[model samples]
Target chain A: MSVYPISSPPSPQAVMDTSFWSLCCYCGLEPYLWKVWARPIWVPTVVKNQIFYHAGDYPDQQAFQQAEHEGLLAIRDPQIRITQFRSGEREVLSLAQEVSATALIDDFSAHRYAGTILGLDTVGVLEFLVSLLEAEIITLAQAESAYHQLVQLRATNQGWLKWAYNQIKQRGGNP
Target chain B: MATHPQLPLTPEEVAELHRLIAWTGLEEPEALHKLVEAGLAALRLEAALHLYATAPLSTGEIAEQTGIPRGQLIRTIQERRVAPYEDPTIDQPALYRDLDERLKRRVARWKGQA
Candidate 1:
């Protein structure tokens, strides 16, 4: 296990919300998303507290811990404290701003903050799956299956699901 | 240093996103973008409060409707003191009807704002 360098030159990073990470695991997209993330996936301290420490015995906890331990996931503390949102979401939004990175937020409310207030590019979990599909990293069936799995977990909304399905079909993928 | 590729959303995806945005009853793109800026917890608490005061639904039912977890709903109910169990003497049907009217007015105002 290695530590990700905090002082490394700014790279294309994605500050993830705890829910997004958990949803990825629930949708069985962990391995593919991990491979696709080539760069460091920043995980704010508050998110670690919420997803790993507080969410007791979740199946994804071990994998997330391992990813962090292996330097694939970088655990960071936001220098600027944001009091407007909940801890994990606040830290994620703050870190995304601090690094000028894309906010990988799955929660609707949190995504709004990133998109409207912070004026940052926001990507949802479904969008990530779509990206993977577009990059040929995953098949359309895999993306659709992941969407269904996420639906079962109640981690996604109907509107986004339909949008993703339509997007997949338009991209010449069989959704 | 590694760079991440952008998520490949086609023109059709963007159109679909706009359609979904309109479904939220907001015509302006900016207004739709502003929809969920308020925290989910706050929205849930507001919804919970409305349901607690008006609806004959249980805490579990409220949680289901609001997408809040049952455990969190129980804790919120206890902390907020807004459950039926806390005050069993209210006229449920009358309260429901009253709140229904109030909520309609609020929604109309929100739509106007949008």
Candidate 2:
């Protein structure tokens, strides 16, 4: 718990969805994200519910609990029309769209919706990991470990993810 | 420098075997044995990847379906590099770079650092 940031970045505040939070926490990057992103990432209140109730990642739950007094995970409702997506995804897109901030999402459908439908800047957990590496927030070994855990957590067969992993492995964690 | 074990066969079965041998003009069964072995390996590889690609099953589940051991399946996957994550977004690193300026603005902020 006594992790010191290798460096800091101006991480433009982004609206986060539940899966993104859960995945980051699941892969041991939650506190690092909290320490590195500088700006408090926004999340809908329902996203809070999703994290506390639905998320199976204990680290994510614990991270949220520890972050309570820090005000890094800002909770707000993006009051909007509901869609076929879950409240968390809908609200993240809504909030990001309303404020024109990037949406931090990892679910494939929600990720696509953020970029293609909402026309907002979107970043997935992988890109965020790369950003952390580029900013010197985490070392390459940490990135490699985090990514391997992420790939296992996702349990996906998508090849591009492998390609991206290879790309990151090929590059140094330099900004 | 090889040995041939005698196969238990009835006269009719032997006749049928000879007929097939004559039909194919084959002297030994080594080729058929190897072909079947190679086919099974191909089937297993295909089944494993197909099971992985079609569902979100863990490597254990895929191994269960394909009858491959979990560790073996993982070793094979790592060696071959299959079933990557589903998104193609990482192809564009420039898009991710645009936001770096915003994130790189401040120095390390976590407390209790050396």
* Model 1 C-alpha lDDT per residue in residues B1-114, reported as the tens digit of each score: 111134344565455444433333334444323424553355445555556445544433455556555445433443354423223454445534533343344334323432
Write down the worst ten-residue block by lDDT for model 2 chain B.
B105-114
What is the TM-score of chain A, computed separately for every candidate? Answer: 0.84, 0.82
Model 2: how far residue B47 lies from native, Å: 22
lDDT of 1 by residue, A1-175 (tens): 2322222233356788776777677777776544434356888875666564444566668778877777678888789866656556677788889888778776555665567778876767776776666556678788878877765554353445656676677767665
Please state the error at residue B86 of candidate 1 in Å.
30
Mark the regions of model 1 whose C-alpha exceeds 4 Å error after superposition: A1-11, A34-38, A53-56, A171-175, B1-114
Candidate 2 regions exceeding 4 Å error are A1-11, A35-38, A54-57, A82-84, A156-160, A172-175, B1-114
lDDT of 2 by residue, B20-92 (tens): 3343344547423422456434545545655554444444345555565543444345435455334444444
What tens-digit string does per-residue lDDT give for candidate 2 at A41-77? 7878867775665335466677776665466768877
